[model samples]
Target: MALYRIADINVEYEPRFDMLRERSKKYLIGPSDKVNFKISIKNDDPSKPGDNNSGLSDAECEYIAVGSSFYKGLISFNGLLLHASAVAYENEAYLFSAPCGTGKSTHTSIWQKHFGKDKAVIINDDKPAIRLVNGIPYVYGTPFSGQFDISENISVKLKAITFLHRSDINTIKPMDGSKAIYSFLNQTIKPSEPELKLKAYKTLDTILNSVPVFEMGCNMDEEAAEVAYKAMKEGICNED
Candidate 1:
């Protein structure tokens, strides 16, 4: 068994694959007598079959399994996984969320280019954790950060969440409360258990009430980043 800290939570789990161990090396810590949770995956877990069907090796399968378990466990601590690209700029985090192939990472890369590398850092390219701490929503990086494995073990105060869509011209607008909730829910994991699902909903409610939500239609251009940053950060909608 190994101990690692993620999103300010100490977790103890035995990684049976080298890839998982390597991917999680940065989060490792000295043996701890106390842990927030522990995860143990048996060889015959149901995930193996689904992963195999998806053409992933045993090693890759284990990585997915571990991530799923961790995110599910995070719900108890007022945290849940958000399928988004999280970037930190000037000590604040901005999350761009969307369905797969929607260019979430591409949009954030534009931000890096527009703001300069020194100002923008991709904390988690995928699957970042959002937790409510003392009534503040924060985004955290985890090891299971998509195919590229681009992530840092850091947490930043969340400023806003923007849902992305493809468009010929860059435009953004504030999302309505009902629309925001639906868009946000589609991007996060929904636990199957009754109690955990309720907790997840409550946590999401706190986040929605505390953070701003926007819908941005953008193309892959530096101007896209500029438009989004201006509207989200300064509340200046150029198109309006």
Candidate 2:
């Protein structure tokens, strides 16, 4: 068993997870920073296994165990794990959210190209931990960052959460109230268990109320990125 830090929690995993262990090295924290997630999953008996997919495979079960441990630890502290692409610009986190393969990552990469080195940084490429601390929203880098697996153990003020969709034209519009709520909820986890469901609702409500949200219609091009970033940034800052 080894203790690894992930999303601000020190999780202990018994029998070890090779992928997770390697992924969490950057996030390892001291004992003082521990939040104690006791995670474990039994491996299938290789000798007795007829087929790996006879039921839920060992890998699938391990995935569930890891997620459950993270969420439980997160919920206790009012944190939320969101499926979005997050970038940090000028000390603020700008998140791009969309259904799978809507170019959320591509858009963020364009922003990096537009801003050049160090001007725009990818905070979490996939799963970012959003939490409200002291009534201010912050975006945290987590080890669970999807296929890209890019993350940093850092936190930044959440500037905006934008729902992205492909459009022939490039435009960005701020959304509020119901629209914002709906957009964010779609990119966030919806726990089926009642206790976790209620916690998620509360955390989501806080996110919607605290930050500016937007729906962006954009193409996979530099012009689209430039237009979207300028419009969203200036619009939020109320600058001419």
What's each prediction's TM-score?
Answer: 0.96, 0.84
- Write down the lDDT of every candidate, Cα atoms only: 0.91, 0.75
RMSD (CA, Å), each prediction? 1.2, 4.1
Worst 10 residues of 2 by lDDT: 44-53
Ten-residue region with minimum lDDT total, candidate 1? 46-55
The superposed Cα distance between candidate 1 and the true structure at residue 171, in angstroms, equals 0.4
Per candidate, the number of residue pairs that clash is 0, 0
For candidate 1, write residues 1-240 as lDDT tens digits.
899999989998889989889989999999888899998978888756564586888888889889999999999999988999999998999999999999999999998999998899999999999999997999999988989888999999999999999999999999889999899889988999999999999999999998888899999978999898888788777554
Pairs clashing in candidate 2?
A: none
For model 2, residues 1-240, the per-residue Cα lDDT tens digits are 566666556777653555666676777655554546676555653432335456755544455456546756686578887778899988988989989989989999998888874888888998888888886879988767876578888899988888889988777877757987777777777767798778878888888787777788888778866776665677632222
> Candidate 2, which segments miss by more than 4 Å at Cα?
32-34, 44-65, 236-240
What lDDT is reached at residue 120 by model 1? Answer: 94
